[model samples]
Target chain A: MVDVKSVANPLFLREEELRQAIEMLFFAYRDFTGGPDEMLAEIGLGRAHHRVIYFVGRNPGITVSELLKILRITKQSLSRVLSHLVEEEFIIQTPGERDRRQRLLTLTQKGVELERRLTADQRERIADAFRKAGADAVQGFKLVLHGIIDAPDRERFDVSGGPTHAPVARVGNKIAGDKMPGTKIAGIKR
Target chain B: MVDVKSVANPLFLREEELRQAIEMLFFAYRDFTGGPDEMLAEIGLGRAHHRVIYFVGRNPGITVSELLKILRITKQSLSRVLSHLVEEEFIIQTPGERDRRQRLLTLTQKGVELERRLTADQRERIADAFRKAGADAVQGFKLVLHGIIDAPDRERFDVSGGPTHAPVARVGNKIAGDKMPGTKIAGIKR
Candidate 1:
């Protein structure tokens, strides 16, 4: 039988190592938001605004309830941000055809332009890191992140599969077989 | 020469991929803190308190000023958390040997015990993810995180090198050569 006590000790995580990870989280998150933050700042917007715009842009005609689920924020919190975006003409809300109580949201043309600018910066950063880390490492990185997700959220992630709804077959085959081409993963050319 | 315009196009990142990444960040961070958050909640403490204790424990006899630098919060903000920790006897403060104005801080026994409990949960989470992802993915994940950090903080990360003070050579070698052993990348034993 394997000895489990030795395996579970907290000391296993060296102090310096954990601290390094903490600092990395701080710096990386800051830099990740920096580009889009600047663009938003120019128009007196903030991170919250960017999130609402980005989600609406990604899921055109998505309901407010669905967005709240994806964002995991209370309706009240989301309402403040959504109100601002709508007032700014960055998003449009219409009564749901099937359920009037539900509001369907989509980005306006202006919203689309802004969303493109914000996400483009983020994509470039991820792309640069992917290229630098190489193909194998990218797979491991993504897998680790997937594993770190909460169990319930993981279920949601698997089910919803986000905006594209690319067949799970494609994602699974690519991940399991490690057949994700470097160029393809780098994303399609503009 | 590469085509710069092609790289600049916003369509390079599909809406699906971006949403997936955004979801991953939200879910991963929530799970990453879940274990510790539970422990803290039971003790009537929160993440902010845990952070103060962890840093003080890591750098025994560190000054308030240094702690502020690591935390990146205002004196008033740190004061609230620090006062509570001190009042509860989780931490002890002493006048600096060199500077009368400096207050050097260290964790008390209670603080150490609590710190251990919180960190154990976090370390196990990270270790599991590392093991599951394997050494290659772990390297990629760390590299990408490092790349995401802003330049100055990145320098701070390089300079501090975590609490272990493990020589950069040793740390780099361990990560690069697949020497980390008996660690899981994710999944709790229970």
Candidate 2:
């Protein structure tokens, strides 16, 4: 399928390598999300909903603005998705203690269960890949992916285990460190 | 934030590692597609349209069934997107030579141009990541991603410089080995 003559050119080889990388990323992401997509479809939710559930479950008191920055979607788009989740009781919004006008989002019990199930499907996929690729490959995967992320957001995955921003208030009197089993908050290193 | 006590447990550490991999993938994919998505949005197209344009550009004269298999989208959904591209003259479809009933899809000149533009955006992202992550990390990245893909699709990125399937008919006067620069067909390697 490749033109053998072109392979002799160093520049062309680099281009080919990059092209393969692009396709590999596409296929990897597609299959990575496939399991969750099917589950979301069954519930009449889509990828957007899963993202909200995933992030809110990760950050119990994440504000709408914070989510907007993470998702990079327009305010109107997030509003539609957020309203659907709220109307279905998968998520609840509370006014922030520090700023009464700001709404912080948290997952309801239903939301938590759904997020767990969805994430479990994804976790299985990644675990299998990690197991097959071995530790070295897994490390490379993370490093390359970190490089691909925008610089500002790359701070979210730093291994320092330090808080990158002011701590959002934990809602519902949840005890500290009472997160779901097998979960890690963004940028929270072990 | 992670619980320091939990980090001492090997099982918990593995879980944490997997969770971090999952989050990194989500953010990486979001930022990776960011540029192409913006360009497509400006032209009233979404990622779905871009995928169709991309695969078609890569495999000219690719049959609809082949495309359906690659994209894994429902026939109805593909029909909607395909119709839009056909109407816009971005893509053209012709009956297969061996099987007249089968529709073989190829890009029009406009589609080719658009595919190149969108791919260039993605190419820039991957090239930067590869350069930053270095050759060893890039190899590791591909290995891990290859593991993540489904077993059947893994054949698409074999990197053996061999064709995995029968060749589809080449449309137009596009000479054999005459392809867009910096592009590669699936599974082709140096």
Candidate 3:
């Protein structure tokens, strides 16, 4: 039992603080997606297309429903975006092994190339931030971000296990377990 | 001083980690804005109009150029959105005191009501996260998010001092400086 209207308090949600957080998400997400948005713009696509390419690339055999669930967009909206990607030969749909009626989505080599190129800057940016923040801060960052997500979508977000297809990227270091060596990540130099 | 291709190594861009971070951002931001999006959609407005109202509401006399810079959208695009907001009487523009040539954007009473309703969830979400993560983790959260923003926009992200108007909100405890007692705060109850 604590006092309700304590005059001078230490624990509170500073309106300014919350407002700053809102602005932070806005500016951060804006810049984070800025790179891909520009690249997609060159090809006459938008963030909608990027979302399709990214998810398809990540989950090799993901179904259209799964994608729609993940993206939270209308089937009709996806249909318009998908037609362009398919016509552009960026993504290919194959009959699902488990379900004959299902269409499994995967990116073509060109699609993979484009996806990698589009996300390269993003990857670089995250890697840099993770390095700068250190592993503990990264963990904290993830915790706070995870906490921000809605509970229903949290399950979809923790999506794990590798893609059903062969490896798209050479497995990199265990960033979480290891000391994030900041800039000098041992590898074929960029 | 580091080996390039040391086979079976422990340093590289952990694709899984980066992918998880990307997904976290996608889910977190999606859910974060979902509430406001729905609110705006009811009035036949979208994220664009929401952005206009938000920045103007937050800055309280922010110039159109400043708004344009923050949004990074085209003049024509903003014009369409601004027209709707202005026509609807959600926002009003005034001649600048000094220049008189500049138009200063502010939210009308209707605008303030809508803005508050639209952002109430967002404020609560952030407050809840800050409470859960505590102050230090909030710092980490801000740092990582700040790191995510492009260098150019970083300055704007750090805009300090109160909104250039009378108390828009009753100031609560300083989140950063305080120990963050999880849920205890002066003023405003759940």
DockQ winner among the candidates?
A: 2
DockQ value of candidate 3 = 0.30
Best by lDDT: 2
lDDT of 2 by residue, B1-190 (tens): 4455443565776666777888899899898888998999999999999999988887888878778888998989999999999999999999977779978889999999999899998888888887887666676788889888988677667433221143322223222352323334464533
Reference-based lDDT, residue B68, model 1: 82
Q: Interface RMSD (C-alpha) of each candidate? A: 9.2, 8.3, 8.9
Query: What are the lDDT figures for the candidates, one per model?
Result: 0.65, 0.78, 0.73
Worst 10 residues of 3 chain B by lDDT: B179-188
Tens-digit lDDT track for model 3 on B1-190? 2233323343433775677788789888999999998888999999989889988887787778777877888989999999899999999999988779878888999999999998898998888877777666676677788778787665444322222234233355332332222221211132
Model 1 residue A36 CA deviation in Å: 3.9
Q: Quick one: ranking by TM-score, best first? A: 2, 3, 1
Q: Which runs in model 3 stand beyond 4 Å of their true positions?
A: A1-13, A156-190, B1-13, B158-190
Sort the predicted structures by lDDT, highest score first: 2, 3, 1
> What tens digits encode model 3's per-residue C-alpha lDDT throughout A1-190?
3333222342333775687788889888988898999999998999999989988887777788878887888999999999899999999999977578988888999999999998888988888887876665576677688789887655433322222234233355332322222211111132
Ranking by DockQ: 2, 1, 3
Task: State the DockQ of every prediction.
Answer: 0.30, 0.38, 0.30
